[model samples]
Target: MTLRNIKSVQKTLGLLLTVFSSTMLTPIVIALIYQESTSLVFLASFLITGLFGLVLWLPAKKADTEIRLHEGFIIVASFWVVLALFGALPFFLLPELGLSVTNAVFESTSGLTTTGATILTGLDELPRSLLFYRQ
Candidate 1:
């Protein structure tokens, strides 16, 4: 693949990441409504993810938009991996949740992929924000 194609992928991934970062707002809102302490965590996650996305996009903004077939696949894969990591941020940030990195990643991946598998127990006892995020 040419450098141009790589840049295209980078630009696309950046934009996608920024969009994905905004999804953090849903959980933030849930936290607000439920008066859960996790609001700060979710808001922090949103900012961090969004800024990282903006950093990626800003440098690649001048790159051409056209993407090759391979670049498309690469972008898709990258989206899943990056998004899963960011999606795990809230769980990782929550000290009381007691989630290890592996469990957090698995939980986020499962939620993102809709696998319906979770390591969490006592779902009913968890805060609304966490429940909403997992949903």
Candidate 2:
């Protein structure tokens, strides 16, 4: 891909990331409703994800190039990869879960893909925010 293509992908992925970060607020609401301490976890995840997205977006915001078919493919593939990584933030940040990096990414990817596979053992014991997040 050329630099323009890369910038286009970056711009798309950044906007997607910024939008996706808002989903974390659902869990924050869940946390507040259930009085769970996990609100901070989701809040932190939201800020980090949104900030990273904004950083990616600012540089290419003015790039008004049209996305070709090849660039579309690149964007789709890269979006999933970036989404999975950023989506893992909350799972990785939650200290009570004690999930490793691999497991956290796995869980995030599984959830995003709707695979329903989990390494976690205790569902009932987990906070509502976390449960809502996984769902």
Which structure among the candidates has the greatest lDDT?
2
Candidate 2 residue spans exceeding 4 A from truth: none
lDDT of 2 by residue, 1-135 (tens): 678888888898889999999999999999999899999999999999999999999999888669999989988999899999989999999999889989999999999999989999889999989999999
Global lDDT of each candidate: 0.90, 0.93
C-alpha-based local distance difference test score of model 2: 0.93
Residue pairs clashing, model 2: none
Per-residue alpha-carbon lDDT of model 1 for 1-135, expressed as tens digits? 888888888899889999989888998888998889999999998999999999889889999998778888999999999999988999888887899988899999999989899998888889898888888
TM-score of each: 0.96, 0.97
For each candidate, C-alpha RMSD in Å?
1.0, 0.9
Q: What's the lDDT for residue 114 in model 2?
A: 98
Off by over 4 Å in 1: none
